[model samples]
Target: MVYPEQQLSERQRYYNAKEIAQYYRSRPWVVIWRALTIVWLFARFVLGLKLDEWFNRAELNKFKRAGQLRQILTDLGPTFIKVGQALSTRPDLVRKDFLEELIKLQDQLPPFDNALAFSIIEEELGRTVATMYRQISPDPIAAASLGQVYHAFLTTGEEVAVKVQRPNLLVSIKLDLYLMRWAAGWLSPWLPLNLGHDLTLIVDEFGTKLFEEIDYINEGRNAEKFAKNFRDDPTVKVPLIYWQYTSTRVITLEWIHGLKLTDTERIRAAGLETDAVIKTGVISGLRQLLEHGFFHADPHPGNLFALADGRMAYIDFGMMDQLAQPTKEAIASAVVHLINRDYVELAAIFVELGFLTPDTDIMPIVPAIESVLGEAIGESVGEFNFRTITDKFSELMYDYPFRVPAKFALIIRSLVTQEGLALTLNPNFKIVEVSYPYVARRLLTGESPEMRRRLIDVLFKNGKLRWDRLENMIAIARSDQQFDLLPTAQLGLQYLLSEEGKFLRRQLLLALTEDDRLHTQELQRLWDLVKDDLEPKRLFDVALSSLRVVSTEGIAAILPTANTINSL
Candidate 1:
């Protein structure tokens, strides 16, 4: 029952592939030129492939070398540009100079034909452009590597933005990616040194994300999900999708009017508070990573906006990252441990989160964690710079078995980009400090009873409540509009009476009173608090058992001084 149109479509695809293959076949000389250039550059810059010892005449500067590579990738076109951008995010895989250069690879490629864009819109929607939009701008508003966006108005008088795919983009990208894979296969075995990642691995990862980025349907869905996630939040805005006009090759969305986040002067002139805007951006970013578990992976300044009403609007949902429930919970737990500087528990959480293998030798990893943590903490307890610590940790683990999970890599990149943007707005802004309240709120108000109990464990040690720490946590939680203490406290108290909690309490008491004289008063206080909850006989039996164990070590004086169980 195939119609003539369907038959023609199939035949067109066949020709497209054949044409692409032929196009690549005609480009062997280009490939050889690029490959040889890359080989020479890599050898000279990375491997020190110098001609003569006497001609040591000042090796080419690293930044200059990166510039040369950028030129080569730029000349090779879209696929290489995408690869360079991906490499820019992996500071652990490349030198800082090269990373700096690669990050500057703008997607501002030259635009294709306006006729082609309008024709694609018409063909994909099965409607005439004249009927679809009352007025459509002939010139594109923005042009990038994959596609271009145009300003248009629907017949219903609603202003909208139309994103049109470039003509034969898939075919061109397919050919480029095919050659990339072929090159990766050819060069992988002969690579002189490990660049921290193989070409095959990088190409495959880039190809998947690249393909996903070009799917307008997926992009529309991503926008809808983001809108759903933040529907109730007044400070955040997600674009409204115009499904009546959206398809794989073309998507339409409500046009948002706002100033670029980088335009601090204009944002301020519009009566928006810069600090408040940055705070909202950071908090929303945190919520995406920690609470929602789905986040916009590419959060550069260009993609974010500050509306007239002070709300932050995020556009371009092509790149998004998701964290699983276990990973999110582990991250929340890690935040708590990190704040407390509990390196041991942090190490365990790292393994539990799959940051390291289950059998990873914790002994070797712990010191590395300690060194990074200690350096970040510096001379003060409250001073925590997340970016510095994360960078140091990445460097420390570069050569080791340590690997950042795929989702985590995006998370890191997004947060780093976010913080960088915030700093550009205000140089004195401290992202870690600004983010602490959000982190504390998530840890203290989590739904899990275990998480609440862990909060208690963190707030107390050796039967003494860390009042200062508890107060700081409360202050931070209060800053969050969503934080509620009553329910969290109730859940924590219920957990305290459970068998697991009781065992943990006993262990804490034993560990505290084992050899320290400082807990003499705290132990009595803690006993008075817990004695009513336990049967008198059973409580006395437990106390007496502990006493016998302590008496054998001749530290009986450090035990509770109450004469009778009644006094306790």
Candidate 2:
């Protein structure tokens, strides 16, 4: 049965294994030609490298070979370009020299014909450029694998960026995916792959995301949702989408005027602080992972800009991902487990997060994880960074049954690219230094039940309060300027009197009466740690103000304990 173009496009939004297989099966010539071309390129590069190694010849230097690899991917078109971009962030999979070259794939690509691009825009929007736009660039301002963007102004004098998708993107992407899936099936058996999962699943995941990215309608919606997630955040910016001019092949968004985040010289010339820009990127990135659970999966330097007013602007929302609530909580818990040096729980978390099968024995893997992560975290958390941990974990993946879950592929890419961006601005920048403070503040002040439970887990163990852990968490959280002391205290008091905190209350009472006497030493230690921040005048004002929000019964429930503490 024949289908309309719109219906076909809608049906193609997701990966359909059966449909893809059948479609490619009917195009044997196309597959054969593409396969031959790809194999030829690989043979040329691999043979050259082998010869260089055998003869100790400096003919093809690492930089030259890396450039050739980039050229091959670019020549092969968008699909291979996307794969190159993914590899650019994986230090374990690609060499540093090649990675440096592959990084250019993020934004540096040859533009398609300008005339064809304009025609596509006119065809999609159902109007000539003269009528639709007051002024538009004669050539694309920027060209990417899937699309090229033009700076344009609407007839009503509003500035916008017109992004026109490459000609026949779907056809090219489909053919490439089919060939990739086919190649993976044959290559997996011979390749020295230690990944615990099937290779095709990774291909399928990439295919699905690629399809979504090529859909401008979907990307526009992603932008709107991302903007809403950060509506209250003053430090972040998202371009406004113009739905009237957007389609599956075309998207017009507000033109963002800012400096590329990696351009340190220009940023400094504009009187912007590079350090503050890095902090903004890290904190906003954390919120996306831990709080909203929706994040931009690709945050290369080209996508993030530093605004004139110091806000960080995020553009190009084509690649975004969402985490299930359980997944999100498990990740936050995993961070706490790592900080506490609880490798056993950390191993279990890896299993839960799909890095290992549930049936796999974690006992042997626990020490391996600890040795790798412990060395990466060395002396203090400040020294820890994603790149180091990722490199270490890559080694573990070879030795253990660890695998990169298909779901977490983009998450890793997003994080590594973000760190790469930061490093370009400040060589001394460590992501953990900025990220830990945000995580600590969330654990301390997060109002969700899941976060509250995590907080309790961090603060207590074996039915006793760990005063030292609490003090450490507070000290770390205090480093974040956004951490509000009074609100957190009031939230803590309210939770202590609520139904959810019954377990915590019982645990507290048990610790207090364990020796058949008041255990005031821990309490005194806590008070001393926070005395300066919670001085008498501030405490009194907070108490008086908190009364309006706290129910009388809730206050009554905690009054006896308060009186006992006062007497002490």
* lDDT for residue 50 in candidate 1, whole number 0-100: 44
lDDT of 1 by residue, 1-568 (tens): 1111221243333323345446667888865665676566556654432432245632555556677677666655666666666565445467777766775664444678999899989888889999999999988987665678899999999999899987766665766766666776788556443332345555555565666677777778889889999999999999998888887778899999988776789998999888899888998998888778899877765478899998999988877867777667777767767776778878888788757778888877787788777687666434665566776776655555565554565677787778767765776676766677777876666566555556666777666666456666766665656665544444443443444355545454544555543455655654554344456666556555534443332333223322322242
Model 2 residue runs over 4 Å out of place are 1-8, 53-62, 89-100, 187-194, 513-519, 556-568
User: Which 10 consecutive positions of candidate 1 have the poorest summed lDDT?
Assistant: 1-10
Candidate with maximal lDDT: 2
Candidate models: Cα lDDT each: 0.69, 0.83
lDDT per residue for candidate 2 within 1-568, as digits (tens), equals 2211332355677778679889889889989999999999999999989988988864558899999999999999999998787677565568888988897887778999999999998888888989989999999998888999999999989999999999878888888999988877888776444563567887887888888899888888899899999999999999998877877788999999999876799999999888999999999998899999999987877788999899999998888999987787788778777876888888988999998889999998898999989888888878878888887888886678777888798788888888888877887788888887778778888669988887787777777777677777787777777777778887876677766666777678767766677768877877876787887888888777767677778667766766655664
